[model samples]
Target: MKDAQKPDHVSLNTLIMRLREGQFVIPDFQREFEWKPWDIKELMRSIFLDYYIGSLLLWKGKQENFNALSCERIYGYPKGNGNPVHIVLDGQQRLTAMYYAFLAPDVNLPNRANRALYFVHVDKFMAEEYDDAFNYDWLTRRWSKIIDNPEVQYEQHIFPLAIMGAGGWELPNWVQGYEQFWKNRTQEAEEAGDADAIEMAAKSTENAHLFGEHLKGITEQYQVAYIELDQDLAVDKVCDIFTQINSKGIRLDAFDLINALLKPKGLQLKHMWRAAASRLEFVETEKMNVYILQVMSILRQSYCSPKYLYFLLPGQEKPVRDPDGTRRKEVLITDAQDFEGRWHNAVDALQAAIKLLQHPHEFAAISSKYLPYVSILPVFASIQAHIKTIQASQRLDAQRKARHWYWASVFTNRYSGSVESTSARDFMDMKAWLQDDNAEPPLITEFKTRFKTLEFRKETKRGTSVYNGLFNLLVLMGARDWMSGNVTLADDLDDHHIVPKKWGAEHLQGKVIDTILNRTPLSAETNRHVISDRLPNQYLPDLIAENGEAAVRSILESHCISPAALAILLRDPFTAEDFEEFIAERQRTFQEAIETLLVKERLDLPVQLRELDEQIEQIELGLRKVIVAVLQADSQYELPSHILRNVKERIQRAAKKNAALDGDYYDTLEGKMEFCDLRELHDAIKTKALWPQFQPRFVNKETLNIKFGQLAELRNAIRHSRSADEITRKEGEAAILWFAKVLK
Candidate 1:
């Protein structure tokens, strides 16, 4: 489109008067409400000082062929028609100030110009002047108090115009001279019956020079480039123009211009925002912009950015009905009722999301992008509006419901790829396919095929195995055997080595290898103890006792048979195949438990499950910190300074190590290794005391039954166990809760 033509410069008075006529409206997406009262006063002062403030920018546009112009009420509202004749593209601040100044009941008097503007009664400046004295009383010929007592030492307070007209006038002498001059001029006009003389006397008495000089200054200096756009110009185009021009020193936020266009449509973007803001009262508005962005993210699911809203409805004129009976497209604002209902729905959904967040375990899988999407609430609400129930099973069958849930996840996950890219499109298409009515069977078939092919066992060197292997194992062995096996590879089992590996000369002499058979599972407690002292003999007794003969024999046949017999297993080098089989079995067990645990924990639903992970991580981290603190404190007693320092350093290192893992090691060797840090061990000792309410029972140290000191020894034994006992669900929960309490 060709560039719109510019308009000629106009006077400040004309601009101000035009603005008062409702010549414009600030859009809802425009910048935040930021004009202070003082800024308004300053603009007025400049106008009153005759400073050229600038001209308003006007846009000529059509809404359904009706001629319309964009403008603003620089001075609140006009006395007559409310139609804004002048739309301000620039100089909004100055115009806004002028508009507000006239509406304001109280006028801030300038310090230097105080005596000069004294056309009213001298008493108006006297001690404790009433508000009535300062206002112009039009009925009275002169100011009310001044007319009542014209000769009450008026020259001392009033600034006579005759002296003002004369250059280099001394204030004291000119005051006396102007009083005499006004007296003569008044008498001459009355006696001669000359209208000119009467006008001069009145004008001179009112100190017109002060008002004139102020107006002159405003008209001469302040310059505004007022560009008037043709009706064809779109709101987005205008925004682009505004941004380009203002990009130099001062610039408008993209949303600000968007708001200006959105405001008059009665979209109530600001009101919606305010409502959201109210809900987040705990966070300040300035700090809540992210939250606001999040809301917008939800509102416009297709477009993550709020700025895109402007492009959606691009024009100066309001969207209205066509006169020729033609159909008109509707924007979000077109259906105010529907929009509001949807908005409220979004708000309600957001409230639920926040509640879910309180249990971080539920939101652990949620991405930052997803966070903003959920914050929007509208998208969720709309999908929910169509649903019979938001429950997981019901939603699975509801296509509309599923789509919303899927998109929420997609947007929330941020997809880790560009939305505009082919990859993203494919993903979306796949998601849609999954939700399609006719394609449901094919989708289910594809899922089954994928699930069957999924490797439950995959071996990786120096890292935790995937859950698939673990899940398969859990299913094959059955829950009872899995929970009570020799070596106790159960709830809190950590992946361990059947043969101890160390970073020493002995291992260096042999072939370095990565094998699964060398790996066995131990509980977190046993793993910690074994990590410090890498010897299989120390843990053998515990393993045999916990698992019994059959479990031990099974483990040996599956993992330790390659190198002659089970006794020679630890002495021989581990083969790659041995490692692969062990990892594969573990992965199978892990996969089975993933969904099982989710169900057991009542977090089987998608949303709830996502949240559960976050909560669990938070609880775990909190516990670790508390343990570290106690360990640090405990090190201070009896130990030599060097030994204490060494322990503290190790504890710090362990905490740091755990942090890097991002809380993924719940039942892993690495997790146990972290607990081995003395600081963590110390925290375990203090956990009972720190959380007395939860651990109310006092342990008798003498009897070695649940005492703080005795527990400390138990922690040591668990850490050192070569073959750890199986961890029960209750024990796992207690450990997690204890950590959370300590952190709190």
Candidate 2:
């Protein structure tokens, strides 16, 4: 096949003409417009100075592929197919900036005001005697107005670059007008017979003549270069080139490529994502499009990253060599056939997820406050809620399961770093659940319940902290707006410590009041007017007097304060200071409420290490099991009683030595024994004094020591309370099973 084997370097005028005629297009997979006003100015300065900005990489597609190319133009899209469409694979930013900077307001452009705007400095080429300097100097506005109307706005030089927008920036008439005006003035001066005035007019005319020259230089020239790639290259190869060109500079965002891929099919990804993200009230908009795009990938491609979607394109069997020496065949445009529909589904799922978070049956997120883990959105969006394989009745069941998983994910932070892999896994598991009624819910291997003081404080801040998932669960249990009669919590509400900070400061250190149990959501009105010194008992009567006791009781019930707990704070005398007791009681309820929700839905995981104690598989050390297996290979290597004596004596001697060497106090027997741990015992066993206790009874001492060292590592991890990801499921179970068999 004969491709147009060369690149062409045309004048900037020809490039703009091609763009105006729809020959140049921002391909569907290119990124959304990201240049700012400053970027436009810098680019314009570079162009005016004839600086080499960069070259454009345009994929000059074959007629069929070009015909398939319907894309967003740099400014206004061309009205008719004046030339074959060529995709801009690079130099889009510079081109876009220039196009918008000079797009004429009169060109019947669609939404001209909202698309892009630019302005040019007119002071550089204005008449020195002109009074227009004050009006245009150092101001920023779109250059889409009267650019050449030198006398329109001010006394001196100012030009709207927009005058050049109508494809031909014909030179200005002001200089000529001034020249004609000065010529007329000379005649009048000569007639008046004041020779000195004539001389002054002549000098002004000379200045006017100079401005005309500077004005022509800006309007007549355009300077940008580009390389147009022939259409014979494969789509994958094109993407590779696009990525390589951008890698060292501004890296190509995957969303940009997706935009290019989708535009040919009538999907304006930027507009679609903008609409979707605006609906997300409090979740910050930074990378919101990327997140939604990832969600779309998960639903459509069963992947969380768009880069991975490249391979899913319809590839050809045989590769043909391209002009760039890349051997590749064209992939059909059918690669994006169902993208529009699937993206809509993802949007629907995202809306459903937002709603689920804001208003849930139990453990409601209420708002962004409780959405600590942002990674759950993709997994939630990929639920395949209305898959055809799912029965009508089971759809609701599947949704319920999704909800359970959402809470479990929030509790465990399941969608952390491996968000893509986790989303794919969760979606597959969720899809299976929907299709096959007997499919079990996905497993949550580990979760953490111990909220460290500082982290908990950070997490519990009303709308600011991510720790609100737990707070939301507590609210679901019964925490309600004290004055709102249990209405759904509003974003405007506030939270205050149950034990006032000033009072608790004497009893505690570093924000003793800044805790989940101590903090409770208060109505905005109450928060604004409350007396900080007043105890809940004191505040209760006033609230009851204002809103009535029945309303107050409803608020307390909604806030998850049990009647008994409220009674202690409201006892008529109310003399006893029971903030500690009150806090303890509430904390217990909070913990119980969480457990209740987890058990209610069977979405439970052992969030606490103690919960995994009875089920030792969680903390089991696999290396310990290997050591036991090697020891038990003889089937008769029971530890001698004398070895136990040796171990006990070794522990006692170590404690005494530690006390003497480190000056550690050990008055009680229990205190001395506290230093004893499995690793410590193993260390004692490894000592030369105790090594011979079972040298013959067991296997190789060297082998056992190496395995025991691994066991020591596992013991250290457990002691430090690391996540269970530190150990694998097979390793955990193997350790427990092997140890049990050997111990028996």
- CA lDDT scores, all candidates in order: 0.41, 0.55
Candidate 1, 123-174: lDDT as tens digits: 3422224332232222233443543443433533442222222223233354
What is the per-residue lDDT of model 2 for residues 1-744, given as tens digits with 9 covering 90 to 100? 665324334565565566556566776777776766656667766555444465567887766554454555665444554565678888778776666566542332232234333443344433332222212112225232334345442233344444445564343554566566667777889899989989967765665665455445444444344566778877778777877777756443556555654555566778877777767645654556666666666655566654344432333122234777464544422445455565666677677766766664544666665565666776775674344246665565566666666666765556556676777877887777666654544352222232211233334344332356666665555566665555545666556665566656666656446767667766666655663666676777788889887777766755657676777777654432465566566666655555544533422233343333323532234324433444455654433355445545655555442333222443322333333445544554465654665455434667556554554454334433344565543354444454454334
What TM-score does candidate 1 get on C-alpha atoms? 0.29
Alpha-carbon lDDT of model 1: 0.41
Native-to-model Cα distance after best TM-score fit, residue 367 in candidate 1, in Å: 11
| TM-scores of the candidates in the order shown | 0.29, 0.43
Per-model RMSD to reference: 27.7, 23.0
Q: Report the Cα lDDT for residue 23, model 2.
A: 65
Best by TM-score: 2
